[model samples]
Target: MKTFNAKVNVTLKKSVLDPQGQTVLEALHSLGYKGTENLRVGKYFEVTLNAQDENSAKTQLKEMCEKLLVNTVIEQYEVHLS
Candidate 1:
């Protein structure tokens, strides 16, 4: 087995309302960050796990996300392994 590092980026679906993101965008605009628009807030996770290979690592990471790390009803996730 080999140790792997995984990054999971979880985000709300585009169809869902992102109130936190909207609030952050408003704050940014108030702070003179006018160039920023349509900003969305999301979650990032770094995990270390043991897997047989790169494909296995990615699969494990994605399964983790689907089973517990993410809300499939309102959010989606992407896993990157190294």
Candidate 2:
């Protein structure tokens, strides 16, 4: 088995409302930052996994994201393997 590095990014779906991101955007505007119309917040997870090959590692990582890391009902995820 080989050790692989995985990066999981979880973000609110385009149709979902992100109150936190809105709050941050308001705060930025209040702080005098201009030209910042919209803002979005997301999460990043870095993990190390053991797999027989890159394909397996990607599959496992994708499963992990879908099962536990991301909320499919309101969120979307992108996986990166290295």
**In each prediction, how many residue pairs overlap at the backbone (N, C-alpha, C within less than 3 A)?**
0, 0
Best by lDDT: 2
TM-score of 2: 0.96
lDDT per residue (tens digit) for residues 24-77 in model 2: 999999999978999999999999999999999998988888889998999999
Alpha carbon lDDT at 44, candidate 2? 97
Scanning candidate 2 in windows of ten residues, the lowest lDDT window is: 58-67
Cα lDDT listed for each candidate: 0.90, 0.93
What pairs collide in candidate 1? none
Distance (Å) between predicted and true CA of 80, model 2?
1.1
Q: By how many angstroms RMSD does model 2 differ from the true structure? A: 0.7
Please estimate how well model 1 matches the true structure, expressed as its whole-model Cα lDDT.
Answer: 0.90
* Candidate 1 structure quality by residue, lDDT tens digits, 1-82: 9999888899999999999999999999999999987988999999999999988888778778889999999998888777
Q: Which ranges in model 1 have alpha carbons more than 4 Å from their true place?
A: none
